[model samples]
Target chain A: MATRVSPAAEDREQEGDIVERCRGFMCPPVTDINVLQGSKEEMRTRMEMLIMETQAEFCRALQEVDGGTFKVDRWDRKEGGGGISCVMQDGKVFEKAGVNVSVVFGHLTEEAAKQMRSRGKVLKGKDGKLPFCAMGVSSVIHPKNPHIPTVHFNYRYFEIEEEDGAKQWWFGGGTDLTPVYVNKEDAFQFHNTLKEACDKHHSQYYPDFKKWCDRYFYIRHRGETRGIGGIFFDDLDSPSQEEAFSFVKSCAGTVVPCYLPIVYKHLNDSFTDEEKDWQQVRRGRYVEFNLVYDRGVKFGLATPGSRIESILMSLPLTARWEYMHEPAKGSLEAEMLEVLRNPKEWV
Target chain B: MATRVSPAAEDREQEGDIVERCRGFMCPPVTDINVLQGSKEEMRTRMEMLIMETQAEFCRALQEVDGGTFKVDRWDRKEGGGGISCVMQDGKVFEKAGVNVSVVFGHLTEEAAKQMRSRGKVLKGKDGKLPFCAMGVSSVIHPKNPHIPTVHFNYRYFEIEEEDGAKQWWFGGGTDLTPVYVNKEDAFQFHNTLKEACDKHHSQYYPDFKKWCDRYFYIRHRGETRGIGGIFFDDLDSPSQEEAFSFVKSCAGTVVPCYLPIVYKHLNDSFTDEEKDWQQVRRGRYVEFNLVYDRGVKFGLATPGSRIESILMSLPLTARWEYMHEPAKGSLEAEMLEVLRNPKEWV
Candidate 1:
């Protein structure tokens, strides 16, 4: 009798080859190697691969500037799927930096469904629960130099399957900058780089997403934006899935280019103790925005088996809260505060 | 020519005398001195007076131990009320201490009314708006010594008038402790003091309120209580209005006594830098509890024209966040974590 091989076995063998070829990712992909390899043409596989690549690239770029290596943690959720978290703390130039990628699979609870409905998503599930797959790469980098602004970005792809087998998918992400001291040239360069990325995709992407960023990152109680605006857009199920993916990829690629120039310029800049204190005060506001109002953080906290370390890695290593702390009039700190209170067009 | 004084004029004259008699408060009460003195027999006036007195006493007691005087700010809210905020930052013994009292009058927004309804309050109003008066004294003291522990307490009374002229009144407040290290003796003394206060009014009060405190101060995402429990109660309108007032007074009175002994014992204790770092880490959780889950903080941030400084005064002067920070097994930090993970019956 001739030796025979089942198609599933053949797929697994081929997957093993692919997995070997794809070594040096932050870790093994959260999705099964076989599934990832067999579904080479699927959007889920493509997104997963993209985030892994983006996370590694970003971490390496940051490492090059900071002269520090990231400590990586690969974690699994008992419910389903898992994530990879990389953090660099107390580095030479960076105070704390975290880059994370998670591939999660779960059923949306009724409460989560309700929140989605409020956000204008329509669902056709009898029990208000739907199976979903979500993958994302998120990061926040807090540098030691006060002159170098803290930068944050996250890009995610999500798919939900209703009871009737109807499927819906969307992509979301943004990049934002928060500087301790206003540097007009750096702001111009940052926004111009992002604008160039957006213009390549769509003429309206920069303006629309920049406005969305201002709105979304608002610290309402303080009547100020979290930082100078960048670009923020969500629920983008646009012209086509391929086009949406292209746009997200463009945004994700711009993070290092947009931020590293400022970092390099300020990495060696001398700062006063007063300036450092002011930076800590601003970090306090950053903490308030994340803990009080960040949607991703709220969702992560609510989700069972969520990796909290990854979720809260965005916070600075140290922060301060001085009651009624206010910058004196006509000072550099006040100028920055003014910009935060009234967001400016950078490009 | 005997002055034919109108009754209103006579009341004003008498009120001025009463106001002068109440001169030693932290500052003039948030309520108008005339209204506060003239309405002395009303629950509104009584509650305001009690809070004003409580704030002054607490501030004085803390100042005595810390050897630092509070910087007082009497702020007016444009919409309808004002507050007196007393804060001492970077004191010798205390890192940050704030005691605040506010008397507010406003129409409850639909969102606030809905929150109350969800909490099992029977709110009746037209268009979900009800006129209300609220007064409270709140304090959070963070000591410099890691061994001393941090203490937070609040006492408030509220009254609402429905469109149909129905009135509803209630009292709410609690006291809790957060320690960097577990000291069983301190825990016992703290709980015993609270138990004595609760027992004076009702035998079941200690058990019921202690459980409520544990539940209320929970940091759910961390799967731990904020600290060792004390006493917490809300919507206490039963037995009789007078009786409820008496109970609130008793609880408020115990704060100084319950906390000071611990402070005195640890005031001059030597601690290593490592211990201080751990304390900062614990303060980060305190920040999480207040900013993320504290109901009063949520309400304060939501209210328009609310004084942000007063609301955020509960935060510590400094705090720290470390990625996936865990204590060594069998360490004092681990022992404290065990108590937080599983709250104990101290009294």
Candidate 2:
């Protein structure tokens, strides 16, 4: 059972915790754990650690709230490959959910490898297929509370063998929030935290790329924005290894501090049963958009080594179907429509 | 009340009719309705005559098919502008049907005019918003026969005010087919007819743009082609009015010959009641794809100048939903799935 607290109370506690954590944590901390800089084994080991830490932190945060505690149901390790499937069900915060985190290292098929090469990149393998390895940490958090956003984050590193057998690695990751309700302040705080982290890298990075994220998540058919917005960056690689390393580290470190407070504040708020029902209805659209239109979902589903449960983790606990129901005039639902019609810069 | 004939019987009669029609029509005729394009008043009068002819032809086709004539529900003129909305419903070949063909010429909103201006080439619109005009024939034919494909065809001429106060005119249209069943031979016949028409214009045209039509009609989420495919081209405007006029005329003229044979062939075939039911279920996916992802549907729904029935006319008569039911192994459904999984050139 979760200890109940008001939204304001949660906010105060979260703010203090975030501020304290920010002060104590310095960038580029020393790590004694060996992560091989040049080998696929090193990448795989590092990815495994990353997955454990990310999932543990997610569970710890969820347990603090009134929603259910999710236990990892299964973890299947791949033999000829590498992927871990973790599923959870009937939890206070989640219902029938799976959080899959996997790191795979393998060669692409001939056709697939050719397409990659045409994109001005080469892979390692005979028959023109490159020997490439990837470490991806991905999660779908479908919280029990409709007010609590169903969030998604994916961070991955890719490396390929060169002609001389040298490995070249690149980093990419982004965290995005998908909320049922529109709390402008929560959205602001979410983007603000991300912007601050991004500023440490480059000033132009936050605003330019944040707008890109907004455009990216938009469901053009529904004419609505997906969740408010957050930080998203991809292909963060450079000739300089140090620069790429710093970028990935900064993004990964910002995830917990940036999102947890917003989730914490919203989870405890007083919401009517009616609002919860509306939330579920809205979630149905999210599912349709993701399953039907999302490029990431399509790509992952089409991929050979895809873990289906983890890929579909962002689906809601419940959804609805009406003959056709446009939101009532001047309601919160209508307000959401107005916001959607005109894109806003929350940060 | 509808006429029924064997395929072999019709094939012989159809050939005879074609021979008689082509005997004297083979002599190339040169003519121009150029005077009709002199002014808006002249164009309007010419369009009215064309509309009357089009309506008469449609009425004749229906009367001959059913022996009992289908009644036109009514034709409504625009309250604030000049346009006709011809509608009909609950006919022998159609249920909940609407055939709306309109020719309206008027001014556009400043925003709408501005968007047009961004296309780089200025039309005959004023520097700001000027008197904009359009004349077009658009129709959606939804046959009650699940065996017969639901078809859509549109031929439009758009004129906009240029920055210099001249009129910029262009023509655009094409016909497409959506079939419930996978009949490769029928699909081939349909495309072959259209390709022959297009080939008469430019040798390179059919192959290059036929692929475009196939790619455009795809519902990416379902990974299914909209129907067996047909021809589609938009904005066939060029600098020289003479060249543009000839191309546009060719595009619009191809509709009849390309479609008539395919329609006769499909409609004459008998279908079982169960097949009809299955058609409806497939239509459900069509509805989901359109309402959920189609841009044209979204734009029509959002725009003030939209007609609901016309926009939704692309929907099939029936649809089905089951909780995650994959088709039986080695069935026709699986055959369709095979095609959907990997598209190929049928022609």
Candidate 3:
């Protein structure tokens, strides 16, 4: 894994206008060449290379806006795997940004394997080990500017391999937005960008998956949605494996288009101290949702001997929990709450 | 319950010495007294009064130190019982102080009832309704001064009735401290007070309960203890119900001795902005433990029609999470973390 980043990256980023700066980016670097070797382990390595490359590109794109670079930490799990966690703090654009890529393959614990039974077949190793491989890239960005909305995206693949060389696999992940102040046009642009990606694969994909995103990202205890929803789908072995992989890749492609424009639009916009305080307050709900309810986070934490930092990279840099906080009735803050209480068809 | 509080309460709090101001506290006014009727329902009310009185005295002591009176909020659950929540904010001493007493009795959903079977037998109402009653006072105090430690204490009593007029009951509770910067003498003082209280009732009580507290309050993901341990016990239905209640009350009585002197010791002690930042960072750990791993919080949140505010009073007014933060070696902050990593026999 490469760790060095050029210090002048942001200065170069400022030379071009928004669209010119963002366009014509190449596909993420792919280095794994053993895909045709016909081995499950090689395939797992191929997927790992994809997510690792994706992590590199995503962090590079964010570096352009922030003027701060990532410090990479490479760690290993004694049980079987390791991960690379790239983190940035106190950047010009982002208050905190963490993009983690983990490629872990090992014998699943009994509890984790049993939980997996609901989704697909659990293929054990020749020695009766519950052999499993998982690779994913999950990123959460909390920006310094309140106008620049915080965003999160994660795409993961999992596979179970059996003694007879049979395999059962599935794919999961999504991207969502959390804005301190809701901009109707921003919300529409976000959803529309993702809808286009989904439409290319299947007409029904956009609507069904959009609804899934709404339900999945909800903060139940607060009785509010985490943000204006994007698209989410999981356990996608349904239509066909090749088709599923293509759809996941397409969704991954949309993440930059889906979120960066809003960042570009509001990156230079200014506000008051009160507005910043309001952003910190709303970030508290994001903390509650992840630590208290997100199934992936909980599942990751519960997995025995998993690396803690990589799993918790989703938390914001700072949050506030005011007692019985009630937004002033009919204010912009109140308007945001009203929308959060009821989900809408963003398209 | 009486809702009116004297606005002059805060002015009066500043007149006396620390111990003098804390003593001669008035019990909360009791509005339920059907205990002598020899019904399970009446017994639950009696236990409710005990916790309510405890809550009132606890708040009164905090007010003296804070020079700020609490605002009371009374609410009811549609299922059965209600609660009184006393909260203090923007005080001279405390940033946020919440003391809540709830007496809830009603049917338990099947999943909840099934989980409770480990404690005792569950008896349902005539229509197959699983009857349960819970009464408790849970409090969290967040201090304004960084040197003064944050504290939490909770005491609860529960009972389940049988069809044949037989009763099954138990008691559970604890008090613990979370110091931003640990003072060794202070740690010894806090634990010694609780140990003396425990020894008065039983010789084995302090050691056993202290160990339990250590294990229970641990933040496993961080590979660190939440704070220096105090005392915790649950499912204490052994020997006799009256004995268990006395043991729990004894631990509850130790709450003030365990924490107040440290407040008195550090209340006016000057601290740096960096120290305050460190305190907020530690508070972030407190938030992580409660929302992610605390069993009571999870159970309470999952209970349908539960009062949301009272259940969430443990959160601090503010917290911060910097990525992969490391305290400088030989620094006071690093010293506090050392003690947290390896607990001691503070006596």
Best by lDDT: 1
The stretch of ten residues in a row with the least summed lDDT in candidate 1 chain A is A4-13
DockQ of every candidate structure? 0.77, 0.04, 0.63
lDDT per residue as tens, model 3, A234-325? 88885776667667777777777888889889988998988898898899999999999898899988877887777777888889887788
lDDT of 1 at A83: 95
- Across A291-326, the per-residue lDDT of candidate 1 in tens digits comes to 999999999998878889999999999999999999
- Candidate 1 yields a Cα-based lDDT of 0.88
lDDT of 3: 0.77
lDDT of 2 by residue, B69-187 (tens): 44343233352233333344445665433334555555776666665668564555445557766666565555667776666666666677666766766666666777666778767
Under CAPRI classification, how is model 1 graded?
A: medium
Name the top DockQ candidate: 1
| Cα lDDT of model 2 by residue, A7-124, tens digit | 2222211123222332332111112133322332354444444454555565556556535545443333342344544445556556544445555656755665675567666566
Among all windows of ten consecutive residues in candidate 3 chain A, which has the lowest summed lDDT? A4-13
Q: How many collisions per candidate? A: 0, 24, 0
The full ranking of all candidates by TM-score, starting with the best, is 1, 3, 2
- Across B150-207, the per-residue lDDT of candidate 3 in tens digits comes to 8899999887665665666788888888888878788889889888777766777788
- After the best TM-score superposition of candidate 1, give how far the Cα of residue A275 lies from its true spot, in angstroms: 0.6
